[model samples]
Target: MDLEKRHEPPLRQTPEGCLAVAIRIPVRIVVLVLVVPVRMVWDALVVVGRFLRDTVFRPLGRALSWLARAVFVWPLVALWRYGVVPVGKALGWLGKVLLVIPLTWLYRQVLTPLGHALVSMLAWLYARVLTPVGRAVAWFLRGTGLVLAAIAGGVYAVVAWLARYLLVVPGRWVYEWILAPVGRLIAWCARGVLWVLEMLFDGIGTALYWIGRVLFVLPALALWRWVLVPVGRVLAVVGREVWDALGHAWRVAGRISLAVGRALATLFRWVFVEPVRWAYRTVLTPVGHVVRDVLVRPVAAVARSAGRAAREALAAARESVRQARADFRRMLLGEPRRVEALDRREPTGPETRTLGSSTTALTKD
Candidate 1:
């Protein structure tokens, strides 16, 4: 049994030994069978991806980028640098040579000479024709004015003499002969009438005086002597008593009126003035403030907003009208459109009608 045991391997009995056996078998199978092929496939894919990125895709991207630069960027740069810039410079030179130089030359050489000639001609005309005519006309007008003034002065003097002889002299004669005598006669009659009236007034006054003396003065003296003395004594005593009573009553009435007036003034101050002041302070003033803040200020703001809106609307309308007018002027002056329809293959029948309508509209505008 010892010899057999030494020849045979040791047998395991625990779960740890069993677990090790199971893990070793699978690890060998996975490493040998599955992991080797998988590693190979992954390495191949990496090689292919690297080859594509480095060789194929890189070259393609570089070629595409070069083509884009040549086609788009290089052409634009060349056009701006060489074609557009040179063409613009050439056009500027041509404009200077054709338009500016010619216009300047015309202004300096032709127009200036023509203006000088015209001025010389006008000066000659003034010297030859207008000066003599103007001088003669001024002389004639001055002579005519002098003659007219002399004639007017003589006529005025004659008229003044004639008026003095005809109207003033005759008026004076009439006043002295007819009016003066009539005035004197009327004065004499007035004097006689006044003297007669004076005598009649004196007689009436004297008679009235004698009648008053007889009828009133003597009776008044007799009444005074006989009856007034006794009556005066009795009336004096009664008048004294009545005067004292009236003075007392007047004093009492005045004091009552003053007291009543003071009471009325105090009542009016409390009822009318104080209440009015309180209402103004508490109610009316606050109401005024509320109205200002809420109603009046808002209304003013609305009005301002409406005004601004109206102004903006008016400005927009004016801009639109100005643009329309500019377009109309361009049309009338045969200016080209901003963008041309270059894609059209041919003109159709509608183009003719549209052209005719456009011409008519331009004419109308």
Candidate 2:
């Protein structure tokens, strides 16, 4: 009987049965979760109300009572202490003055400095912004003026063009008509002046011509008279001398004439040859000297200087070639040998690897 009962009771739960029980438990837990929040909020509201009544409302009620008494009595106390009693008023005044004076001084000093800095910043801003605005306004005004001037110029050009095209002929005609009589009068006056000047010039020329003829004739007559007188005296003297000399001593006379001819020739030679020699020496010789000294010598000096410059330039070229040759030899041969001697050293770390690699790859290329 016990064995049969145990076997019957051992009814094992199936997977579907267990799943159904698990689903029912979740439904109950969901119901409890929805209800618990509402319950918790209600409890919390009740607790808060109780706390407010105990801690805040009772204290506030007592404070109001006390504050009503103090408000009713405090003004009279303040009046007795500050207004009527006046106890240690001087000390209070000193304290107030000390506090107020320092506060006022601090306001004046620190606040004034800060205010000045703010004002300066504002002024700088004004300068940066407003000044340019003002200048822009002025520039706009100037542009407006330029536009007005251009407009005026255009108007003036149009007016002038119109005047020339429409009114110029009439204006010229009026001007000609108004000035014609005056121009004729001026021309007549100018002609009269020219006629008067011509007559005056003709009279002057006639006077000058007659005076010149008289002067020339008078001088010629005087010269002829004076020469003829001298000639007559000389001829009479010469005839007497010729008769006496020829009769007494014809041979002596011939000798005297020959002597006189030789003496005159000597005198002419002395006067003309000496003066010509002196003039040649003084004028031609000095001119030749000046040409040689001033013109020819300076030209020769310039030529010599040019020749010297050419020679110096050729020498300098030679010197430069020598220097270049010396430098080339030094650079190509001398410097290389010196560098090779200095470079005679053990291989550096990088150079050794390069040399080993070069040896290994010597035939690769």
The list of candidate 1 runs beyond 4 A from truth reads 1-223, 230-259, 333-365
- Candidate 1's error at 28, in angstroms? 99
What tens-digit string does per-residue lDDT give for candidate 2 at 95-214?
Answer: 889898899999998999999999999999998999999998998899799989999999999999999978998888877987787899999999999999999999999999889879
Candidate 2 is scored at a TM of 0.21
Q: Mind giving the per-residue lDDT tens digits that candidate 1 earns over 69-94? A: 99999999999999999999999999
The C-alpha lDDT values of all candidates are: 0.81, 0.77
The 10-residue segment with the lowest total lDDT in model 2: 245-254
My TM-score estimates for the predictions, one after another, are 0.25, 0.21
Off by over 4 Å in 2: 1-139, 150-171, 178-185, 215-217, 220-365
The ten-residue window of minimal lDDT in model 1 covers: 30-39
Superposed Cα deviation of residue 269, candidate 1 (Å):
2.4
CA RMSD of each candidate after superposition: 56.1, 71.6
